[model samples]
Target: MVDSVKVAGIQMEPKILEKELNLERCLDFIQTAARQGAKLLVFPECALTGYCFSSLDEGLSVAEAIPGPSTEAIASVCRELEVYVVMGLLEKSGNKCYNALAFVGPEGLIGSYRKIHLPYLGIDRFATPGNRPFRVYDTPVGRVGLNICFDVRFPESSRVMALQGAEVIALPTNWPKGAESAPRFIVHTRAYENRVNYIAVDRVGVERGFRFIGQSKIVDYNGRTLAEADVSREEIIYADLDLKATREKRVVIIPGEFELPLFEGRRPEFYGLICERGESVEC
Candidate 1:
């Protein structure tokens, strides 16, 4: 297993309802990133199909099944380049449509993550909530986990993945203008609290008049920002992550004088309210 790996995040604008064009753009980015020595390349949410869909039917029109045409094409590229690619798309399974991210490696389609926490925005407003549990995909690059746009707001999402031994968590997001705080603070907070490397890839450009904020970034396990992109542009950010360092959750500052045993110090028994579903009551 490689302890050190270079990762890249592609922040680009996707034309709404243009699957083929978006796929071509994704392919171009994939080739460029791979050539630049990135083993893991992550794209923004709904890179294949644009967000801000007017209806569920519209989302369904472009949604495809996992291991479908897109993943197969991406897998072929990965096979040729020996790289891993994670891109967001609308997924159709049975009678439900989900906002999802597909993890494709050189081997083939590794797995996919449905957006569990769906905010009332874009395709998620009409899409079905994710039914599966949060999963961490163990790859040659590292133990990688995935989260969609709004999932980052819920700390439990990242906590679960971190507990499952996720060395790197990729967050494919489509943040609009009002969501400036997310890129400024949330990414670092999640990485610091979980003691895992985090990458939040967001889109750029206006979609149906809703402009996306393109502050895609890569943060280290200790909450340090390795690379960050501007707020409005198409760009690729790279960061060399130390997978082995992320495994050492115990941060010994001055030989235990000020140490933080992240997971080991968790007191889960007292955090029961987090899992309890109940009527909203002012505490």
Candidate 2:
């Protein structure tokens, strides 16, 4: 049987548009998590760029291709420290830009996921949507998935990952102050509905005139938050995800199927009734 995994969330501030500073900060955070005996570490969204970079040109300037500078830096720690790391980076893919996350492990770089849903605000101007819905990377610990800020809002996305045998859902986010509840609700609900672990790492402090509330947390499959950090403080949160207990409960409670209704399940006669009424499918 697989063993329980120790995970850490880096809830901290970042230097705006400076990849060097961000890389250094990540290295320190990785060391800190390793010292705490964490097997995996999750960092906040745009942890490298600190979100809200002033110009698209400037943001893209900082954006690096996956397997480029960012992953290589973390690759050293993964090899030396033997910890799995999920970190956010601005990705420049040809002419378009994506808010992306990279998964690094002791074996080297595992996989990268582009953020599917881009939140509105100034970010809408700089980021583009990813064509894919979910990305699950195979790690020594287990299969881990990535869900960016707005992607967690869509239940379809989370269910797809859970259906794919994801043992953990790692989220990277930047939310303005007073918007903390959304991340909390979304992450907790994902854990509960999917019967899998969920982690959310958020950025603290303001960047480029935007306020970010940090309340990073880790949730168990039963929707219990094992650990949560303060809103404003730059902190590192740690916890052990009891994979054994979660799988046992899955067999007992029999978690709902993580899938959507099919077209065959549709009531075409009723649908024709609604269309005949000159309206949409539902209220």
Candidate 3:
């Protein structure tokens, strides 16, 4: 019901294998952002537990159930601050481990999204692929969707959420040194293509010798950079996002002449190949 929401992206480093320390850091950041009138706060991928684990056992060590102690702690803080947060952490389900983002609010645990696309680097190399379908959670802030680090690379993920009426997509990512192009191009491209406000929060500092690029960014529905962080510092970037404006997919520059009905002009019938998989389905 809110027309606009102030979003904050916390760009901080998580210590490897230090769950308690990371949780403390997250609480500190949450308090700081909430006090600043930020309605929605997003943290980097594995912000509760650092990425680049050597093995699945190691990841599972810090990994917890979605609504377990860590999320409960966050929910308590959210209740006091009256805010919403999307934070990344490793998830342990039975014998499998997954890289996930938990969406918590003042009420309680809203939902969680597991990383569907598993890149061959860091903990993702060993984590189980996400099993659930993409979902958009309607909250006090807006219709918010969740995605992890590698999931941003796939256009289908964002498109799916956009089709589900998601106004904002919170992407908690851990971008290393070689993945500079993601923040530079992909974040804004996804925002423009989907007409949804996109916030990508990335971590800083080195974990296991892999230096993460901390260029956390917040882009509007029009793909404009509202706020951005530096490459190697711990910082918080803020943006006042217009949720109502994101829902207006039809853009009229000259009223009758230069009108762009982005969603209305979609040709899903011809885009069947996007849903097809396997090597048999040729490009």
Candidate 4:
């Protein structure tokens, strides 16, 4: 894998139920980001199809199969530009529709991640919950993990990826208004705790009466913001990630007294309470 790579987060608004127009805009953004030297580019959740669907039928109407038209078109572009892309879209598999992210490279479709955690808001209320375990895929850039909007709220999602040797965690989110703490603080906390690069790409504009907050950003392994986009504008944020630094989880802050052994010090036996089934608590 390359030691350092330039990555980008495409933050744009998608027209509701306008698949053709959204695909066109997504292609344009991919081309633009490729021209700017971004090896890996990530788009927001439902970047091709807008969120906030009124019912399951509405979501099914726009959902497409994984190796279907959308991925084929994006794979062709990836082949031409020689860049890897991770984009979120509505995926239709058998009789179920899922909130999924597709990873495409210069060769073809690499892999995909179905959103495991489903929230009550937007299309997630109607989409089927993902059944697969959290996974980390090895890529030309580095080992990367995928997750969507509400999935970030659970620390185990990112921790599982980091445990599997993921150097970067890409979160394609649709963070609506009244949830500013996620991008402002949680994103950094996730990266710092895992010692891995984190990229949260969010869209802007109102959809189905609910407004989305767009503060797309990329944070390094040290939990420092490398780049961030405006809250209300369409923009692309880029950052150079160092693979070597991300792989080194241990941090020696004070030589001998305050060294942080991020991975080696894990006490997994006491964390079984997180897996025990119980009533959900509302914070």
Q: For each predicted model, how many residue pairs clash, with residues at least 3 apart or on different chains?
A: 0, 0, 0, 0
Off by over 4 Å in 1: 279-283
Instruction: Name the regions of candidate 3 deviating beyond 4 angstroms.
Output: 279-283
- lDDT by residue for model 1 (1-283), tens: 6798999999999998999999998998999999999999999999999999999999999999997999999999999999999999999987789999999999999999899998899998899999999999989999999999889999999999999999999999999999999999999999999989998999999999898989999999988999999889899999999999888888888894888888899899988888877755346
lDDT value, residue 34 of candidate 2: 96
Worst 10 residues of 4 by lDDT: 274-283
Best by TM-score: 3
Better of 1 and 3 by TM-score: 3
For candidate 3, the lDDT comes to 0.94
Predicted candidate 3 versus true structure: per-residue lDDT over 202-278, tens digit per residue: 99999999999999999999999999999999999999999998888898899899999999999899998877886
- RMSD for each model, in Å, please? 1.1, 4.9, 1.0, 1.8
* Candidate 2 lDDT by residue in tens digits, 1-283: 4658889999989887788998898899899889989988999988887678656787788898988878998999899999999999888888778888988998778988888877675454678888765767767776788988777887768777877777888988887876777666878888887778999888888876788888889998888999998888999999988765545323433338554333224465654443344434454
Give TM-scores for every candidate, taking all chains together and pairing residue i with residue i: 0.98, 0.87, 0.98, 0.97
Q: Which pairs of residues have clashing backbones in candidate 4?
A: none
Q: Which candidate gets the maximum lDDT versus the true structure?
A: 3
Q: Candidate 1: global Cα-lDDT?
A: 0.93
Off by over 4 Å in 4: 280-283
